[model samples]
Target chain A: MNKVITINLGGNAYQLEEGGYDALRSYLDAAGRRLEGNPDRDEIIADIERAIADKVRGVLGANKTVVLAREVAAIIAEMGPVEDTADADTAAGTPESTPAAAPGTAGAKIPPRRLYKIREGAMVSGVCNGLAAYFRVDVTLVRLVFAFVTFFYGTGLLVYIILAIVIPSAETTEEKAAAQGTPAATAQEFIRRARAGYYEGMRTFGDRKAHREWRRRFKDEMRDWSRDFRQEMHQHANRWWQQGGPTWTPRSGAWFALPFLSLFLGLIAILGLWVGYTLITSGTVIGLPLPASMPVWVAILFLIVVIQAIRWPFKAMRRSYYCGGYGPPCCGPLGFLWHLCVWAAVIWFIYWLTQGGHSATLHDLAQHLPGKLHHALSSLKQWWEQL
Target chain B: MSVNEKFSSLRKGLLEFLVLKVIAGDKVYAADILQELSGTEFATQEGTLYPLLSKLRREELVDYEWKESEAGPPRKYYRLTAKGREQLQETLDYWQKINATLKNLGLKSRP
Candidate 1:
């Protein structure tokens, strides 16, 4: 007997059997997720609910009976498979316009079962174990069948060899899950459970004296294997070095220009500082006039440029401070500070330019133009007047 | 792409316009509209139709009011708004333009 559940869809109550209710709820949930980012998501869902309610009515007709699971499934099928709906939207060439509401629907469909060798249970070959697993039979029974076949004819050996060669081993967690018809959750969980079961089976001989024994044995096995691996790696490394293997080293001779570059950068930094000092003192830096006199913002801007110029060489020097295999030198904090100075200088410079600095600077620049250019400008002006 | 898939996609695009045209002709419930569209190429699943109606209503191209039914639960009767009429006219003009262009090119309008 199936339990009945009451559901509210589109402001109307529906009487649905438990299976139908679950299917409808999941379908609707999947649809909701598919249309999550849509602006009219709520309206669309509401409309879907109304359509479902109408479907329920059509199925029930005058009987007013509880809806069945098959009825719900039929309705969902008519609505079309969730994945198909998403695919159609994509195939329609309007993915940007249509949001994928059913992200989980992609994985909901189970892949087909495949045959895999079960290494967990095998005496001669994993063929019997794999066949048993595929058919959900006892491994002993499969072995008995092979034994009987061997007595009748020598084809059993050849058959077992062929099966073993063809079938894939259930080595990974996902492969094991596929072999056993179970969904793969995590490799760690699968490995832990497999180890615990294997050890438990082994400990059955001693009447299960200690539960912690299995864990200790597993850890010791892992440790021994790692130790042997490390020793082998050490031996290989020594052999490689003896055979004249190349080692990573910085090209010290290639960086011979560092000193000269540092000197040139230092000179530029000093010039910037001198220009900033002149601007502070006489409202002009390197013959470029400031806005009227030295405003606080302009002075601050000039100081920032001078400081950045001084820090630039230092930053570049740090970039190659520790080369070779040590990775790139970190200038995170210094870079952040330099960027802050640059932004402050830019903002202040823009403020100064907007506050009557444009005309004053242009006047100074225009007065410094060459005689030939000034004469060409006058001739062009006279020709334009005549035209 | 196969011919069937192309036709399917072409039909899917026109569904919304065809539905709006149906509602513009008369104020009708979902079942009635479905009945009218039955045996026609414009026929679509209820799941596909309802959401479209709701979207059109949201866009202010259509409006609906619930009325109690004799057979079962209340039904939402849908009618085209003034904006919907204007949209329908524009859609018709666009369709006519395309049809005329296709005719001038000596190609069949429907495939």
Candidate 2:
């Protein structure tokens, strides 16, 4: 005695076996997801449901009351996969649209590829496997490339973390199909691929063994190349020394440092001007008689400049890395200027501390406090009398 | 490419044209249309036909009327609109032109 459930489809109640009902529900849900953006989605779905109901009635033939799972499967197959219906709609819209064909078949068009991290057979996060699948390259090659890049300032580690966050995982059958560039047009296709473990594209045992062998060979080749490179470097150094110790041109050496020197000098000049203005106005640079509110504003300005100075280099580095180049030369020169300003600010702050700026400001405040306090008390008394 | 895949893709491109032609013949029920094409290469499932018909209706190339059915609820009987007939005629003309071009090319290459 199988469990039976009554479902309302196309305004008619039909008794379906539990398994059959689940299958039908999932199929309709998938179809609904596919037709999400269509204006006539409800009508189309209704039509499909009505057609299914009509077919179910024919299958029943006044004898069977409850639809069986086997019958439902057969009915679904005869009606064709949900993807075929969706694809037909899209194919009409785009004249040259390629219908997704089942993978591993001759003349099958590979589905448009998407990067999705695989969960199965993953070493760390399935980033490398995802990359390998997308490019149709060996997983070992991708892992090796990442391993090599990691040696350079841990760039690969940073990139991996970012990709892990940004690239979605292959959670759904459709997403898995997209990750592998395969077509899971039908439920049967998905089941077949799942049974074959096809979604575990590149991290199988055989591939792992091959990767180990490749890594060992790579290490051997690297050792040989380094030894040869060191020998060549030694020979060049000896030849250079024998020719003439080293012709160090003063102009050439100074040319590179000139920009740094000018920027430093400019920073010092700006600092000196600021100090002079404060000294001339306030007898003690920090004893400016301005309202107490001014200090907070100045501190906020200082903080803003400091944070911007610190953030510039990291932003530039990220941009250059993601943009796939050494980035603009302005990044280097501007970065130096920002650093110089930050250093200047630090030195000026230290100078102020050492020069008793804090004490002088305190002293100035103390002098003004009593008179201000007396004035405030009198104003309070007058306001109380008026009240 | 495999011949089967090529044929299917070709059929897919021509399926809409065939659907328009079928509707142009007479006002017909969806089941009747399916039956008419069952023996031909243009035969398709209800799942495929319903969506195609829905798209056609949305595009204003076809219109449907709800008519009482003998056995069940009111059924949608479809017929081509003026725009649909115009589109069908244009497609037929284009197909004929291509057909003639293919024949001419075949004749020129035969000897």
Candidate 3:
């Protein structure tokens, strides 16, 4: 069974077989490409579709409403190829050239088609027409394609609306000409070149009128340049931050904490080294006896403090690298809490060492320790006594 | 160029003049213009006529008004402007001169 597709042609609706729709759509597209940039683009396409719709209606009598591919092909053949119609127009314009040159070839120098909504004959935003010209498709078919997409997903409307808003309207003849990629210098560019006296030098003229013309063009060029510059600056002001330009947003909190973190890390390093040096040479750390002959608990606590001090800087560096984008390991308050934990761990280790050095605490810890550790401590005590 | 190509160009050269002459006679719609040209060698499609009409309109040689039609849609009724009449007169005079010259040379312009 053939699937039927609904299509709106020249304000009239018809249900056509899917294959017939494709055939008709492609035929219309060919016609549209040939007539791109013509002032009567919309009217011509509408007329063709109207004629075809009338023919299709005749073919689909009172009983059968479905239009098959063969019927569409027959209708297209009766209408004739779009190129013949275009040729007739071209011949009307330039009678000397039989089989007029393709619209796309502009003396072998076709400029890239720029996106611009044509001002004249625009329905709604003119995006569909502009796109049709750019893609060399029928405006009607382009609109139909957009309608289908919008019906299925609804993104087509959003995209079309955004394009309509963003694409500048081609208000002037020069803009309309350039919209079709005709390599014509814009008025601004012409004025700039004239002011530079490029064309003036080529002409063998050293007259006052020539100089006066140059001065006038120079004035116009300067005015246009200044206006464009002001407009650009105004636009930039709105999106300066996103473009990575200079902005007034306050520095991130990380910037403020960086110096403090460096200072704290340095202090911890110095304290850990001082404690280690004092314990090794003078048998004391922070005015507390944390000697090599202390209880196993005090020794283990000192080892942990030294290891943490060594690992702190490397861990912070890794965290910063990861926070750049890789992982959300250290960020804002979480980072601060991590630093607080490190500080607390170091201080607690220091406090434990000071108390563990006391003879009463050592004896308490000694009783709780395993018998093997007690024997080892007693042997160290005997050795210290001999020394 | 081939004979066919030359003939195509020859036919094309007369289309605008013919179109102006047709519009000058009566206020015509696009379909009417095509129908009138159907008997002539200048018979063309609506696609070609619309563009030419619009170009003529832009040049102030022709003007059109959107008139409600009993047919399918509102059609653009086109009429020749004063500028168009003057252009048609000039073109006709030139063509007559050319035809006279061709006749003097023992060649007739008419098929």
Candidate 4:
């Protein structure tokens, strides 16, 4: 027969059957472990307790004493499963194997768990430490990568802001454990590695009610993971783009000169041959060709100067310093070389076109003007120079 | 002399001197205090102890400070106040009377 007893909980006295007390004790022990990181633990526990009490009152109102364990178990099943401490206890380390509170000896009170903002940070969601608990990676690596991403494409920073908002902060002992990568902590990153842990079987006790809650959390994790994964992919692609479009990539300081360099090099090659060929063709624009009779070897030398002399040297310099990642250059010399080459090409092309034999294009504009008009323009230029 | 006589006396008979005795020896955080109690088989739900200590604080019997931790947030440590020491003195005196009364009846061992 079940015996009557009044056990004190916290400061409140609870009158329950002997059988009920044992069940409550075991259930609470299990529930405490599960409720570690969950924010709504107290509310959930209170609700479950009230439900159990109501069930007990209903049964005992008719029968004065001697309630069965079956009655309480039935009620608990409707609330949620009891923690499966068998395996969890091994992982819990200290709390499980330790004895429950002893009588007469003073209990040292534990302060409530608190969440402080992390320090020594880079742009990693301020939540990377939190994420590391989930993923089990070195904090340093996360920080390093985070720095690089923020340095380039600072716009990508909004992703971290989104994460800090979307991801729940750890604020309790259980949450801290999870945030630190302890087994059984519900850290989403940790849960991801467990493979088998996704649903990890129906909870041991509180079968019906717990199932509903479990399903909800599972769905939430899926959505959050998908969003996080997508963000990660985007960052990776942006990094690859910054490396180079093809041979000799561009950089910010030197990147702006790329278009001008191409134009300069093309103009130099055209002018070199055209002017040399113009000199060969009696200074008329007779489809300028390389001055072949002037010695093919010198022409070859001239071609080298045309392409490689100014621009190629700078191209080599730009090639040397071309490091990627907007965070900061780790001293990439090729990048500097490429920039120099571009400048050389543009400068040399402009220099040759003016000083080298006149191009038909420049001469044509001169010829198009009427003789009288041309004389008047020359005189106007002289007048302005004198002033 | 009815139920309260039995239950109240039962509650009162268990001297709360343990409370003073616990705090008298050393400074402690609430968690350590609970842990010490558990070792002695005195079970406590965190819910119960926090309120008890909060009352102690309110009465100016105890004081606490927030201390930082490397891995986590700051912790609060409790120390006895001057008023707390006076309360302890009064409790000791009251205990002496109960022991004296029992002694007058020619009962008990060490007073």
Question: Which candidate number maximizes TM-score?
Answer: 2
Best by lDDT: 2
Q: Cα miss at B12, model 2 (Å)? A: 1.0
TM-score of chain A of each: 0.26, 0.38, 0.27, 0.23
Predicted candidate 2: interface RMSD?
Answer: 5.4
TM-score pick, better of 3 and 4: 3
TM-score of 4: 0.23
Residue-wise C-alpha lDDT for candidate 3, range B1-111, written one tens digit per residue: 666455776776677788899999999877788789887667775445655676677789998887876544566788999999999999999999998898788555767
TM-score of each: 0.39, 0.42, 0.39, 0.23
Candidate 2: residue A223 lDDT (0-100): 79
**CA shift of B66, model 2, Å:** 1.0
Off by over 4 Å in 4: A1-387, B1-17, B39-43, B106-111
Superposition error at A194 for model 4 (Å): 18
What is the docking quality class of candidate 2? incorrect
Model 4 chain A lDDT-worst window of ten: A101-110
Better of 2 and 4 by TM-score: 2
The best-first sequence of candidates by DockQ reads: 2, 1, 3, 4
How displaced is residue A122 in candidate 4, in Å? 46
Instruction: Name the regions of candidate 2 deviating beyond 4 angstroms.
Output: A83-387, B106-111
Q: What is residue A226's positional error in candidate 1, in angstroms? A: 33
Extract clashing residue pairs from model 1. Answer: A33-A101, A34-A100, A34-A101, A34-A102, A35-A101
**Superposed Cα deviation of residue A197, candidate 3 (Å):** 65
Q: Of the pair 3 and 4, which is ahead by DockQ?
A: 3
The true-versus-predicted C-alpha distance at residue B50 of model 4, in Å, is 0.8
Residues A1-387 of candidate 1 have per-residue lDDT tens digits of: 455789997677888865566566656755565565666667667767877787887888556678876677667655532222323453331221222322112223333456888766455337788788778888889977765554322234446655776898887544555676654322223234434563345335444545355446546744754565466567667876996774434357535655666677677667755665465445576777766655746565656666675666565653454343333323456554646444454444344443442545544654576775888899999999999
